[model samples]
Target: MIMQKGKVKIAAVGLGNRTCKYLRYVEEHGESAELVAVVDPDPSKADWAREAFSLSSEHCFRSFDELAASGLQLDACIIGTPDLYHHELAVAAMRSGWHVLLEKPMGQTEEQCRDIVEVSAETGRIVTVCYILRYHPYFMKLNELSSDPRMGKILSIKHIERVGKDRTAHTFVRGPWNMKEMNTTVFFTKCCHDVDFVLWLTGGQVESVKSEKGTRIFTSADAPAGAADRCVRCAVEQGCPYSAVDLYLRRKDWIKGFVAQPGESQEDMILRMLDESRYGRCVYCCPENDVIDRQSVVMEMADGVKAEVVMECVTDEKDRYTVIECENAVITGDESSIEVTYKDSSVPQEKYDFQWTRGMEFHAGADHQVVKEFIDSIASGELQTRTPSSEALASHLICFRAEK
Candidate 1:
């Protein structure tokens, strides 16, 4: 289905960090995708979109229902809402004749994920999950090399995600994702991409999953002696790495967007949030912090490929490391480069670099490429050929089974 020659009209549901990426993509590719409508419960988010895209008030909605009832025609919608709300919004958009670019995990439960797959098939809509890693050049190249005859059949694969300690504290400890039952597990929330990569690179279905997880460090027992519940009141806050002052106050640029509310200066906002919000709480003592700081999952694939994925929120640098052992070659890589060694001593080792930029366009530029692919697919009247929702569901199912 080739689309007619024109801009692919798009609406954004939930104006969060991921939505911001979609906004950036549409802005960058103005000729390919048009930002027509925006929805979020927060008016500030809606206003941000309206100002960014020059959208009229009528097109700025507070919820998906409002946008659907408005009767405005659109080619597709990007659902960047929270984990739990993905199914409802995505299904609604698909039923209304709009293609969907859904964020990963699909939903919190396996049932919700299957419903999305069903709805997508019923509606014949293109649902591309945000598996950005699949679009990264490094992984793309790795996939290419995996199929090379020289590599032979893959026997085993291991993937590791080292999420920086500060990030773990910021996002999983003091942030919205702190509670597993309320949000999702560490594997589903942070390492779903890894599970998907294992399946993709091995070309094998997951036969069984066994996992072990625990909050080894970020617990009340690990709190510093005499430390206050809030960093603002802690006597040792100046020296603590996860101090609210250091994390939020020192980083004014980072604080401005999310923390600094209307009429509040950066300093004032930081001080207030530290005194009143969970972001300023001691990481080890945060009552809401329940997710694991580290986890390991071992999986048996249908083709007899043994795979292991380790997720640790204790590193200084955040990146993915993967190693694949094939019959004739050993492949190893991080986010930027890959190294392949052939079994034959005469064959020299080959190294390839992806040259990915560090921040914003992280995941080795997959962040941008995924959006580009989504927009291109919609404009071309074709389904997303790669990293579709069905493929994402397979990964999500593995995470669910592993967590159980």
Candidate 2:
């Protein structure tokens, strides 16, 4: 692939929210890259592209083969397809002479990841895995906070993911992410970011993990009598905030933007839509939802950096909960100040209730910062992708062990 005037000619394989984000990023920036080809089975999405952006008609292909065979001068391609197809698509694109910006989990298995890495080395092409949360602004702050020497040797990490009630019932519990077997295991698919973060924070490899998960509130059997496996239709939906009846067809502003904004290059709209949509399907319940609804991992990383990851679908609203107690560490947030309390270790059993707040304010949402950096790296190869095929496998190694 020849570099055209130092700009990479790119093709996007999947037309999902992620694909759209990269496309929009290029559209808005109008400098980092160019969209030379797009591949998606959805004609409507293809049509939207032509109308919203001046994408060439011939540049669109119904399949990857068509795109590769079209002889379009392309340097890189974004593999935004589902988790199962990532490896296959990525390998194909690499063999076709395209560098890859792969969406995360790298692949569903360690073997698959290794295969991709081997192929990349053999092909001499760049491959960046998309762990979007790593680029979010908030996460960068967390990274900075974790580096405080005054924070003392970090002992544990408290991570709580409040997968909204609506999302639990309508999508997660009922959709592609429903089962651990159909696609990638739940850990690799949903919590890969947390795993990566834990690895980054501890600066060590995860030695071992013990986890437990189950379907807490929603179940196919729990559906109204005679209810189908899917919750798109059920009599009890109106009363249950998380029921599929209520969340099934609900569309948030982000979803609207995802559908309406054809030339959109930012992930803000998709993130908002995911944030606004209350359907419980994407996270907790769907046909493909086989992963644990809630689970915790106790990680023993190298150097004895102990950490714990907790993921729960039981929250009224979508929010994050975090706390760090240490002196000399300046903690700040975009919204509110974080309160830190410390007591004298030398003190005998105290009879008094004490509270201390002197450190920096604590803000939330580091995932967004992780995502932004990913885009920047793609635009300007200044920041090499840390979560490449090789580095990515270390996180999923724990999940593979759990399957046994």
Candidate 3:
């Protein structure tokens, strides 16, 4: 995984919505990284990448095997495939002597995650799992404050991932990640970042976990009596908050490349997708959609720190609210701000605020920050893979245990 000519030549295995961030990074920061090739089974995605990166036809591969056989020089590979394919793709990339920037929930199962860790160690290839929150300014500040002596030793922590109802419908209800059987659990698919953040902030290994999960709203029995299977044909589509027509058509830019195809107008694509694709499926009536809409897990850490993680898909807003209690003070924050208050009467409560003035700034600008770090690490050979497979596995094991 050696850098050539001061730039890290990279290839993206999956060109989905998440991978767009990496592609954009390489596009903007040509001095640091170069996107040389892309691989996806979908020819439309290949075409999108080719135009996005100005890649040659020879550089567009339909599969990883094709890329490998092409003998293209790559310093690293970004694995943005679906959850289940992560283990195999990551292992193959590492074995091929390319460093890996894998998307989260390292693998579908604990054993698969362990296999990735073992392969990474065996190959001496850098494997950074995309736990983007670690790079976010707010969470980074929280980590720094936790280590301050004035904050005292941490006692317990509570983290809640509020997946807004609109997001739940767009993603978990009718999108690619609608079911546990086809993908993974809601915890792994959505809240693995939360789990990884808990591990990062606590700096302790989880000892045990107890969890309870269920779906309350998005089920067949909960569907309105007059509802149709697809929102485009439904009588209440106008008033429905989770209407596929409104989501895909009205909010075209929200998920641009994912729903809208190349050369197709937003209105036309929205109509076609709604009429033909699973994205148009009614939330409560989609039989194949079965992931839990809400869940909570209680975890005991090795250092006797108690932590509770709650994931709710029905919330009105999408934000991470975290409260960490220490021996002398309590710290609380969301994506944009943080506040700390001490028990001592003489001490005053302190607050820190952040400004999200640009695009993809919701996660405290971690979306691009993580990409910068990965590119810089590869270029300098410093390789600061903050969340390596072994580190990521701890959080994943907790998820696996809790699900049981």
In candidate 1, how many Å is residue 288 off?
Answer: 1.7
TM-score per candidate, chains pooled: 0.94, 0.77, 0.95
Model 1: per-residue Cα lDDT over 1-404, one tens digit each:
76658998999998898888777878988989899999999988877788889999999999899999999989899998878788889999999999998988788899889988898898999889988878867777888999898899999999999998778878888888888886789778899988898888887878889998865578888888989988878999888878877888786423534635789876787788878887878897888677888899999988899999999887987888889999999999876778999989799999987554455354556777888888888778777647788778888888888888
lDDT of 1: 0.84
lDDT of 3 by residue, 191-310 (tens): 887888888888887888999886567887888778898998899888888888887778763456554565887678778878887787888777777788889988999899998899
- Model-by-model lDDT, in order? 0.84, 0.61, 0.84
lDDT of 2: 0.61
Q: How many pairs of residues collide in each model?
A: 0, 52, 0
Ranked by lDDT, the better of candidates 1 and 2 is 1
| Displacement of the residue 289 alpha carbon in candidate 2, Å | 4.9
lDDT tens per residue, model 2, 1-404:
33235655778888876677666666765565677788988887778777667788898778888998898888788888778888889999989987788888677877888899899889866677776545544555566666766456666666656665555443356455655665755555767777776677667767778776655555454545544333344444455555443333343322332343556544543443344433323222343345566777777766666666666765675544444333433232211233323344443321211112112211122223323444456446453565676676666676666545
Of candidate 2, the 10-residue stretch with the lowest lDDT total is 350-359
Point out where model 2 deviates above 4 Å: 1-4, 224-234, 248-289, 323-383
RMSD values, in order shown? 1.9, 7.4, 2.0
How far off is residue 103 in model 1, in Å? 0.6
Q: How far is candidate 2 from the true structure (C-alpha RMSD, Å)?
A: 7.4
